[model samples]
Target chain A: MSFFSKIFHPSSYAPSAPSLPYSYDQQGQTYSTTSYPGNYSHQQQQQSYYGQGTSGGGGGYSYGHSGFPPGTSPDVIRSFEMVDRDRSGFIDENELQQALSSGYQRFHIKTVRLLMFLFKNPHDSRRLGPKEFAALWSCLGQWRGIYERYDRDRSGKIDLLELRDALYGIGLATPSSVLQVLISKYDDGSGRKIELNFDSFVECGVILKGLTEKFKEKDKGYTGTASFDYDEFMSMVIPFLVSYD
Target chain B: MSFFSKIFHPSSYAPSAPSLPYSYDQQGQTYSTTSYPGNYSHQQQQQSYYGQGTSGGGGGYSYGHSGFPPGTSPDVIRSFEMVDRDRSGFIDENELQQALSSGYQRFHIKTVRLLMFLFKNPHDSRRLGPKEFAALWSCLGQWRGIYERYDRDRSGKIDLLELRDALYGIGLATPSSVLQVLISKYDDGSGRKIELNFDSFVECGVILKGLTEKFKEKDKGYTGTASFDYDEFMSMVIPFLVSYD
Candidate 1:
């Protein structure tokens, strides 16, 4: 079966799909197919606002007022410039990927591409200038803050003990065995102490955060217990597996 | 077929499954069945640590040194007490659910149940004391901070415009139509201005975050595009659907 057909299979939608109340066109633009209850003045207002395009700033690229402008941290800006290897005052996909993976761990290529897509100016798709880079930098700053909070010993890197603490701090009740696997997987293999530098640390955090959210969704009863038949478990894990591959 | 059988069908494990390296017994406990490459001193250390139980904090509930104690925020503490309704100094499942669903909108029961499980002491699952409540509250605080940062008008709530920016800020390029559907779904119908209070705000954030992560996992080629067959789409959405139900 084709990918789209598999995703939009009739039976899967038959029992409970009405809850979505929206449909997608061939180009993947979503539209509301069902009439929402009530007068819904706000929705109308939004419709008109979106209709205005530039005035409403309603398109995919225009984030409207809530989108904070990028930060002005010198260290962060310097890092961005340094990564812009060509000195063209802009960082492209390759440069950004290199910055994230060099001297650390190799990031999944897709992750690098997504970051580039998100931070690149909507007007200029080829590269990221300082402002756009600053926004990306700020997001990293948030992750860095999380990393620092978990790095209790003030060490530049996170040891196995600290990693365990960091996972729990984020509210994931990760099994000891799973934690064991992660430490072994990310360790630099230097045989010093199983530790992760900032880049590796952030990657681990992202994966754990994503997986934990998915697990919570399945274990909705909050029983601290979840059972997944083999197929269900495979579905839950396929993304992680595919990414690693 | 039963859920477990569906998930664990032997055929599913025949080829690609070996890469997972972990297997579950009847109780759902995960153990590594494959020997990892290398001597893996760190894994040995962790095994010994976990083996010590009380000393190593290996049990499922122990959380070990990784579990940081709750913060001492007076305002946050007050909110927990307010939710405790019975003045018993503890929030039971019902009270906690009521608090989350009370003024703004009724959250999914499963979501509330999951929250309860995550915060409740593993040994005493019936209710949450101030410390446990505080931890949950602090996590909410992080979400609130993100909300406020995006809520430029300081209106104490998020409108459609703000919601779009918030999603983008978190790296999701949700189409405008999807944003419209979300706002309409959450608006209380009071009609002043379609907006979301703190509780509703946090709920929206959680759903968007989960979906975005899933989407990214699939769009690994970094083309900023993804296609899902019917089953794939259903898997992406089942969590949101089940929660609403």
Candidate 2:
């Protein structure tokens, strides 16, 4: 089975069974299973977490104990290095922007800034070195894990239905029509399939996660509910829509 | 003294003396001090923390003892209600986005996402009620505190020199040239003065904090030092430069 397919197989979803074995080299650019040291057991632990949603207390998903659950992959690290144009051991904002825009597709500058903010060290708020880059790489992996978990048919893509599940799984309550709008925005009108690949999956995740979190913030009192007028809703969702431009 | 001046006076930097008081209403649209209990004391605690960097172990700045340090403001709450477009007693994603973008200057979708993610409750990830919105508002207050603390002249603006201090205060080791480039980006080439206002200050803080944290992640050995190749350094610094566009 393909790596993505293998991870989504019904057998892998069994609460008791460990999921697939996945690991990356220190650079996080390459993937390997041999000589990976305790990764299988780690994957097992992670799979159990994913299978049961035991880490559901946070209202969002938690991939591993902390710090790069699947560990960093060589592919992720190499992506960062490619962006490090000057061969500096660190990745700064411009380099990061270039890397992200070119590699992951163009993200809003604010989104890129936020991602950098989210990924960078709290103490060293200037640049990202190898370890920091690894953390970022690992984050993508976590998102991948989320994507794979929801790609139940092992299709390596997420349809509208799967997208709904993915959002709900991560704690979003998007309306059907709103979701349709979102899907249509990304749909290239290629095939009848209204599905998202890994990149689109990540993008969708980013937008949904952001919107949901923002909504929850307003819903203080722990009531799980808040109100918004039309303008407020537009302000929140329009930026994420493709047509916002 | 002016609000900005009062907060940034050199004496305000004293470790023991409490700093000035600042608070936002529910919408965070208006700034007010009425009906805000204990916020002054809370500001005192927060200022002391900022002045001495007592919470310095993590290599990043820490705002409160827990979540919502200065607590929420009435204006922040009002802001949420204003955004409840449908009057359905709930502000959905679109409403939330509209409120945020129009109210807070157009933030990157990703940044908005991160804010939502950070502010939303763990258990209820769908909508944000008043309390959650308060938490989000308070976070902006915290960012404002950071901004005010660094606005040494109480100018309500962060000059390039002040920006340097802001970065350093947050535990970044920025080179002078890198700092210069960053200043030039926001200079506007008007007067010889190069500075950032509140919004820009907040943006700079987010980027700096993210990068610093990322750097610290790599300095795992805690030798208090990490190295970067030329390309790596470029990647790290270029993002903060003024002329990147």
Per-prediction interface RMSD?
17.8, 19.3
Candidate 1 off by > 4 Å? A1-245, B1-91, B98-138, B187-192, B226-233
lDDT of 1 by residue, B45-151 (tens): 11211121111112223222223232243344446657778988777767877765534455545455445543455445557776566555544444545666778
- Model 1 Cα lDDT, one tens digit per residue, A5-32: 2222222211100111011111233222
Which stretches of candidate 2 lie above 4 Å from their native place? Answer: A1-196, A200-245, B1-73, B90-93, B102-105, B148-164, B167-245
lDDT of 2 by residue, A96-136 (tens): 65654434345345444444544555445556666566555
Q: DockQ of each model against the real complex?
A: 0.01, 0.02
RMSD of 1: 25.7
* lDDT of model 2, residue B39: 16
Cα-based lDDT at residue A95, candidate 2: 76
True contacts kept of 1: 0.00
Worst 10 residues of 1 chain B by lDDT: B15-24
